[model samples]
Target: MKMLAAVVVLFLAAGLSDSVILTKCGLKQQLQTSLTLPPNTTNVLAQIVCHVQLTSNFNTSAIKTINETEKPHESQGPRRGRSAKNVRPTKVTPKPHLESGEDKNEFWTLYGLFQLSDHVVCNSTQRHSLNLCGLTCNKLLDNDISDDLACVQVLINKMTAVIPDPETAKHIHKMISLIYQPECANAKASVYFADCPQP
Candidate 1:
């Protein structure tokens, strides 16, 4: 019984450690400075930072969703026996927009698909690589057409070694295929805007 308990505890510890590593690797801000430079300019560090940024964004969004769901809203005061109408709704500031609808829709579609791809890619790997490519590829799909093709090529190399689980790989493959869909490819010919594209 004691041996069994020890084994279970060790398994739990290992799982906990992976969770910590995943959390540490997933924050977008953590990798921002490092990923800004071209991948070739910084060598392995840039590639690693890029991969970490993609994965970190996935984890950040997932955690944010969970936190938001569990968070108690002050607006729900009536549920807590206070007068609900007395509580003010939280005001959200809007972000600036500069792109036209077609371009915005295309960029957003790529953004959402990349987020989904990161989750699938990360799930299949036994160990995470710092060279994950989803977000970098998304840049190519967006209106900003000046991103270095070499950068995309380098990021692509990062995921090559990963042997993804068959099921998730199918989904990842599908999302990737959408990137080159005729409409999306045609739309990319025009540079939609010159400013930095928002993530």
Candidate 2:
């Protein structure tokens, strides 16, 4: 019995090792390499770092499920005609259980560091999704963050394409603020990146 338990523990640990919790500097480095910011927009990197810290606390496997009831009418299909400027902040809540014969217990889940959504971004087996990111939700939950960064890049491109040059930075900042909690809008990098070594 002791040997069996040891094996079981090892197996569980191995399974849990798939995800990673990145440090502030580590994440900043990853973003620096993965993202392509607009010209003269270096400050946006700090904001991006803060946004990830607030959203998932740098946990690569972080998952937040928003039930259909919380986001009514969104379960039908991908949200269309919604620009980056109008994106709403995600409301984090515990996964709810619905009784049988009730509406489908579909949930629009946010995955990984950036909390990319299943309804509008990544595809999942749970329901019909737009899959704008053209990748699986599971892909976002691993130690690898290339897929997450790619999806974010797609969003940034879309946002910059519509807005004029003068308002580009403001619009991008506003869009980032809207996607996360209200506090993220005012978050300072110094607060979150205090532990990271200066460049």
Candidate 3:
């Protein structure tokens, strides 16, 4: 009974602490390569469930979309002739493709970035009590900026092959820079972003 109470208290405390502000879906879309998942919810729930998901909308779609987006493998057939040319079938070669590996789980990576930035803002002990938030943004000038750059590189390499749009791509890139840039005293990164409604 005591343990259960402890866990519940921890849950609410964490939730309130990690309160969300802005969620950059466009930025995630950029890093995630605009691999659209099934449209399934309202803006309210988006923060709670955003990075919380394990599977990616991309990988799920890949099984279906790959054929259309990717080039078909060359068909192999048995060579016909006599002894020397003895009819062995050639193996088909699949086209080389980009793999997101874990990056496909856009939310997980973003959440991780947020968690790291949170360290810079709140004391290490306070890190435990954080809520499920959407923004999961970073607001450090130098350090978070470095992380954002790394994330951008990951997404550019992973998602570009899928999205293939320059303008949307640029928009996402810009947002990533915005996410990591520092704000005032920095009580929490999300608070600053969530304060004003997203334009």
Predicted structure with the largest lDDT when compared to the true one: 2
lDDT score, candidate 3, position 86: 23
Number of residue pairs clashing in candidate 3, backbone atoms closer than 3 angstroms, sequence gap of 3 or more or interchain: 6
Model 1 clash pairs are 26-56
lDDT computed for candidate 1: 0.31
Per model, state how many residue pairs clash: 1, 0, 6
lDDT per residue (tens digit) for residues 34-140 in model 2: 98878876556666766666556678888777663442223223435543223443445556745566767555577888877776667787766666689989999
Q: How far is candidate 3 from the true structure (C-alpha RMSD, Å)?
A: 20.5
Worst 10 residues of 2 by lDDT: 68-77
Which portions of model 1 miss their true places by more than 4 Å? 1-113, 124-155, 158-171, 194-199
Compared with the true structure, what per-residue lDDT tens digits does model 1 show for residues 92-133?
222233355633321111222122232322222322322234
**Each model's lDDT:** 0.31, 0.66, 0.29
lDDT of 3 at 197: 46
Q: What is the TM-score of each candidate against the true structure?
A: 0.22, 0.66, 0.17
Question: Which regions in candidate 3 have their CA more than 4 angstroms from the true location?
Answer: 1-163, 179-199
Q: Judged by TM-score relative to the true structure, which candidate is superior, 1 or 2?
A: 2
Error of 1 at 18 (Å): 23
Ranking by TM-score: 2, 1, 3
Query: Candidate 3: which pairs clash?
Result: 14-129, 14-130, 14-131, 15-131, 18-130, 18-131
